[model samples]
Target: MDTSDVAETLDHLVADATDHHYSPYTRFDWVDELDEQQWWMTPDLLSVAGTRHARELDEKQLMRLSKWEAVNFFSLNIHGIRELLIEVTRRIHTPGFELPSEFFHRFLGEENGHMWFFAQFCLRYGDKIYPDKSLPVTTTEEDTDVAHFLVFARILVFEELVDHFNLRMGRDATLHPLIREVNQVHHDDEWRHIIMGRKLVGLLYEPLRERGDQDLRDRLDLYLRRYITASVQSLYNPSVYRDAGIAEPFAFREELLKDPARTAYHETFFKRITGFLSSQEIISGSPFEGSRV
Candidate 1:
């Protein structure tokens, strides 16, 4: 799609946003307190790795796991949103993207608001957020712009995967009312974000492929793989392990990584993402070939 098509798509997205916009401050009754005894994991979604493992723990262990997992998830969202906002803001005012600039401005405002509320939740209850960890870098001298594009593309891929879950969880009335509302609000905005990202990534990929830079393609695949791998690692909660009386949280992480169920789930998530890239022709079939680190 060309610039005009993108601008049109964005206009539709903006209209959709207007239809779905929600204010957490007003929509959710913050005065209705959540009981500590309630499980944060909705019954229908209890099969998630962390939730399944959490069931094996005692009350103290479950509480620690809940707090750590909540912080970890929120922290990742904060970091990811910040990075994407920077990228969008840098390009919004640049020449040649005038038509879609207005949509991007709205996107940045919505994401910034998301980052603020997520960070606020972490700080209010968790006391502190999780530390920032850099994703593995995969780049080469030739066609550096392709490398940068791939970084954001990989991020978009992850966001889409999470959005799939959020979309489902949001509509489930059986879930905790507050959790459902949060997911509903997030998914509403994310639908527009994912559409914009897919269009932008496709636009960026054509020139890179035209250059026929094998090294650039290789680096792109490496970045994609590293992003998916690290996303799985994000699910590991060292604090949970510590509370469960497991010594050497790192070793426990390693053990959990080896578990067949966990491994399969991780692969399932990445496979869905990689499948999208492959279908889009952004990455060839030989992804992550001859990459080490």
Candidate 2:
């Protein structure tokens, strides 16, 4: 309810933090044991799954696509975790944090471990992490508090998007053992991170409300929706399609993105967050308008 209630929840989280910690080192076998022909993502979850274009691909192509799709997915995680580490770690010993800092320390440790394992996968197999193509723009604002609120809110938006992937991929049996284990470990850690994010974002939003800042509201709404679209779109890498030998990868990406089935799948990707953001009056219901492209 209140920020204090949020802190209380975090206190409980901090108390239980040690119990949830996993050593990325000991838990997974890092050998080159993956079958290149095996899938790294679920076939049903593939970008082109429900499209008529599905008929064009043979079994070998599907496996090849899933292989790189996995690389793309894990590379995105590596990028995301690094971004979060920058945000969370910088906030840890700062003035405002009184109760959550201890938990944040624990959080930072877990995230660092996640970065290591995720990068290991990308580097070991793909030999390169996907460089982030979009540069983030930071706007200077007079209201530092409002800015702080937006930063944390943006973090929540990003976390929840990845949370959907982790929730599914962790349990998807068709994926390779290493990928599944990575997904599950990250999922376990992210449960606490998402809890912290929802609480923190709600607490920060009240200040903007008190200031009667519709401009800021509109700005955040736009950012959140755009970020969601970008996150979902990353899952459908053009390189994955091209490498799979799909013709005209860019044109195919455009077609698949607009496909009704893919559009609906995009909706499902943001389903949990869409309702919550709408209920919070933080954004319009389904701001991506079920077209999360």
* Top of the candidates by TM-score: 2
lDDT of 2 by residue, 145-252 (tens): 767776777677777777788889889887777788888888888888888887787777777777787887898788777767777777777777777778899898
Clash statistics: count for each candidate: 0, 0
In angstroms, give how far residue 221 of model 2 lies from its true place.
1.7
CA lDDT, every prediction?
0.64, 0.78
Error of 1 at 163 (Å): 1.4
Candidate 1 lands at a TM-score of 0.81
* Candidate 2 local distance difference test against the native: 0.78
lDDT tens digits by residue: candidate 1, 155-224: 6876876676567668877546766666677787887888877877777777787888888677676666
Which candidate leads the pack in lDDT? 2
Deviation of model 2 at 212, angstroms: 2.1
